[model samples]
Target: MKINFQGAEIHYSIAGEGEATVMLHGFLESSEIWEEFLPEFSRYGKIITVDLPGHGRSGCLDEIHSMDLMAEVVLEVMKTTGVKKANFIGHSMGGYVGLAFLEKHPGMLQDFMLLNSTPQADSEEKKEIRDRSVELVKRNKPAYVTMAINNLLSPKNTGKFSEEIEILKERALKFPTRGITAALEGMKIRTNKTEVLKSFSGNKILVAGRQDPLVNIKELKQLAEESGCGFISFSGGHLSYIENKVQFIKLCISSKK
Candidate 1:
């Protein structure tokens, strides 16, 4: 279904029934990415999957869709669906949105987990990389999406998931350059949320990938330990939900602190 927000259409899907649980997908991905796991996840509670602004069927709301803006969109979805409080699971960029949500709407969150994501802001070097990616997307979107999705997977599994990679690329290619650049710009400016994690009064989980190229697993593990949040790791890369589905599901299910 779609919710009209700020003159843009925000696409979302709802399944099953019980305590609400929201699932937010990463960059270049849509709510569809969670389709395979929805049935199983819904067994736990009502699962709501959302397409971030400028992603999937959702429309871009601004030139730069900040993490805070995306969080507000999620909040609107919850309100539309009559969800007062819900657990959250966010992957990559989606995790950044989750932290922003916590910062602004603390009372609405029952708990949250960051999957292959961090509470830290983008480093200068990473911001430079995002700048480069923005330019690349403007010049050659398809090529950039292919390379970006490939880089998200573990090198060892690239060949193993070639067909899956192709599908992902096709979906990512549908994103407009404007949306892509806006997302990159937003990510470049996000503030460090480590303190947000430390001060949260409810449960939190930090799931990292041993071979993740995008996140520093050691640093994230340290943050999790320091903040007293549960930490889990797997032999995979950034896309642990795809690379290690079974274990990832178990970890998420057990994250209800």
Candidate 2:
């Protein structure tokens, strides 16, 4: 179903009949990424997936969809659905939004997991890259999307997951160029939230991809240790859930407790 928040229509889906579990998709991705696992996940609890502000069936909100703005959307969605507290799982950009949620509603998180994501803000180098990306997308969206999806998977597994990558690219291509650029702008300016994660005493986890080109594994592991959150590693790239589905599912189920 869809709801209006801040004058923008947001798309979301909820299934099952127990505790709430919110799954937020990453940049260039929609809630569709979680559709395959809905049946199994819903069996464990009420699973909620959102298209966010500018992806999937959701309408774009602003030229810059800031993390806090996205988090507010999540908050409003939860209120509309009568979810007071829920387990949160975020992938990539979705993780930044999740951390914002943790900060905004500390009492509302039963558990949280960062999948192939981090709590750190974009570095200066990354910011420059994002700026370039915004301009590039405006000029050639498909080219960037295709290249990005290609590089997201480990080189070793690219051939093995070629079909899946193509599907991802197809979906990404459908996302509005404005929305894509807005997300990039938002991610570029996000604040560091490592301290926020450190203070949470709930069942928090950080699933890292050893081969992830985007995240710094060494720093992430250190963050996990310093924050006292559970750490799990996969031999894949940024899209750990796709690169390592079986292990990802097992970890998700175990976190349901």
Candidate 3:
């Protein structure tokens, strides 16, 4: 189904029954990524997936789709489903949106799992990379997508997961220059939400890949400990959902509470 958000069309999907579970995809990804795993999730409860602004079938709302903007869109979509609260399983950029949601609507959350993501904002070094990435996306989106997706997995699994990488590239290549750049810009300016997670009354979990190129697993585990959130470490990289699909699915099913 679809909804009108700030005059832009936002596409979302609903499946199964019982408790509501919202799965948010990472940057350059659409709700389509959850198609294969929806069956497992739906078996336990209602699963809701939405294409953030400028991604998937959704239309772009602005030149810079900040986390707050995307979080608002998520809230609007959930309300359309008549759900006042839902479990969160957000991947990468989606996790950023989830943090934004919790920060804005603290009482509207049941449980949260940040998969291969963090509540920390970008450092100056990362911000520099993001700015460069934005320029690269604008100059040549296909090349940037190709490089970005490949870098997400552990270098050791390059040959083993070639097919999976190809699939990611194929879908990511469909994203528009504006959509890609907007996401990068938003991430670049995101604020640190470590306190937000620490203060969340609901259950909080952090799932990370041991060799994630984008996120520092050590820091994630430390944050989890300091914030009193449960932490799970998968034996792979940033794309744990793809790198360790079986384990990732098990974690998702087991963590549903």
Candidate 4:
């Protein structure tokens, strides 16, 4: 269904009942990524899947120019859907959005599951990468974004699952250029949330790919270790959840219970 927020429409889906679980997809992806796994998760509790502004069916947002704005969009979704609190699961850029949400709206989340994402801000090199990405996107649409994402996974993952990777690439190609611009801009300017991680009070799980280059696995481990949160790993790269979804779902359900 569509929920009107700030003149833009956010599309979302709801399934089952019990404590709420919100599934947030990464940049250039939509709520549809959860289709294969949401059914299994629904057996555990209420599942809410949302299309963040500029992604999926949630079309063109007027004011969503930062990660903080993305978080506000999520809060707006929760309010519109009548979810007072929820357990949040986010991957990649979605994790950044989740962090922004937690920083701005603390009491609204019961617990969090960060999948293949980091709370650290961009380093100079990372900033340069994001800057180049912005220029590349402007010059050639989503080709750069898709190519960058493909590189985030292992060779085996891509070679064996070429079709899946191609599908994601195609879907990503449809992402609004302006929206991608907004998201990249957010990444460039976002502050480090390491302090926010320390302040987190709820049950948390940090899931990472053993080969993820975008997010340092050691840093992820340090965050989980320091925060006393559970840390789980898979054999793939940045898109570990998609590559190894069985373990991903297991971690999500197990963490909730």
Candidate 5:
């Protein structure tokens, strides 16, 4: 269903019933990305899937949708749905927003998991890449999205998941230039929340992709260790939910147990 938040329409869906489990999709993706895992996850609890502002059916809130702002949007959804507290699973950019949420509303998180994501902020190099992405989005959003989705998957699995990749690209094409650039700017300025994860007294999990081009596996593993969170690795790229679905789901279930 859609809710008005700060003059923007936010889209979200909740299914099954039990403790709450919120799933936030990454950049360029909508709540639909979590569809395959919803049935299984819902069996455990009420699973919520949300379309972050500027993506999917959600409307943009501003020129830059900061992680803090996005987290507030998620909080609004939970409050509206009568969820006092919930476990959170975030993918890529979604994870960044989760960190922001953790910092802003620590008591609200029963547990948290980062899928193909990290707690670290963008490095100088990554920030430059994001800056470039903003420019690319303005010049050619389709090409930028295509290149991004292709690179997110391991080169070895690209052919295997070619159809899926195309579909993702199509979905990404729906993003307006303003939204795309806004996300890039927001991600570029996000603060490092490794300490937030470390101090969290609740259960946390970090699932890293060994072949992920976007994340530094070694760094993420170190962060997981330092934070005393469970660490799991998969032999795939950033899209481990698709590349290694079984193990991913198993880890998710086990994390909550």
Candidate 6:
């Protein structure tokens, strides 16, 4: 469904019932990425999945687009859906948004989960890569999406999760070139949320992949230690949820309780 917010339509999927639980997908992904385990999450409460602006079927804004803006878009979805407070589960860029949401709107989160994501800003090297991705997407869209998927998976998990990666690639290939540029720009300007995560004194969980290159286990361990949140590791790459849905849901359920 579309939630109208500040003249932008936010696309969201609502499933099951009871308390609310929101799921935010990573960059180049839509809420549909959670289809496989929506039923599982729904068993605990209503499961909400959202497509951040410039992704999936959501509309974009010409205003200052940042991770905080994305979180506000999500907040609007919650208000419109009558979800006073909900547990949040975020992946990659979505994790940044989750931290942003906590910083800006702490009262709305009952519990938060960071899955295969981190609070640190990209390094100078990583920032350069993001800049290049924007340029490449504008010049050759398919190659940009293809290369992105290639970099996201670890070599060992590549062959094992190739089919899942292809599914995500399809989602990326469908993105608007201009939207991808906007996303990269948003990523570049996002504030380093390490402090936000550290200062957040609330119920939270840290979930990491054993083989995730982007946010290594060491980084997640540090976050867990610094923030005093429970941490769990699964066997997979960055896309742990795709490869280990059972363990992911189990950890989420256990952490919240």
Query: Would you list the C-alpha lDDT of every candidate in the order shown?
Result: 0.91, 0.93, 0.92, 0.84, 0.92, 0.83
Best lDDT goes to which candidate?
Answer: 2
Name the candidate that leads on TM-score.
2
Cand. 5 TM to true fold: 0.98
Write down the lDDT that model 1 would get.
0.91
**What are the per-residue Cα lDDT tens digits for candidate 3 across 189-229?**
99999999999989989999999999999999999998889
Clash count for each candidate, listed in order shown: 0, 0, 0, 0, 0, 0
* lDDT of candidate 2 over 105-186, digit per residue (tens): 9999989999989999999999999999999999999999998889998889999999988988999998999999999999
Runs off by more than 4 Å, candidate 6: 255-257
* Candidate 2, superposed: residue stretches over 4 Å from native: none
Write model 6 residue lDDT over 1-257, tens digit each, in one string: 89887787889999988888899989888888899888667787899999998889887875335888898899889988999988889998888899889899888888888988888788888889888988798899999889887777767878888888898899888877776788788877888777777776777778888888788799779878887787888877788787787777787676435
TM-score of 6: 0.94
Write the candidate numbers in order of decreasing TM-score. 2, 5, 3, 1, 4, 6
Which scores better on lDDT, 2 or 6? 2
Candidate 4 local lDDT, 77-108, one digit each (tens): 88987899999999888888899999988899
* TM-score per candidate: 0.97, 0.99, 0.98, 0.95, 0.98, 0.94
- Structure candidate 3, residue pairs in collision: none
Span of 10 residues, lowest total lDDT, candidate 6: 248-257
Evaluated against the true structure, the overall lDDT of model 2 is 0.93
Q: Rank the candidates by lDDT, best first.
A: 2, 3, 5, 1, 4, 6
Spell out the clash pairs found in candidate 1.
none
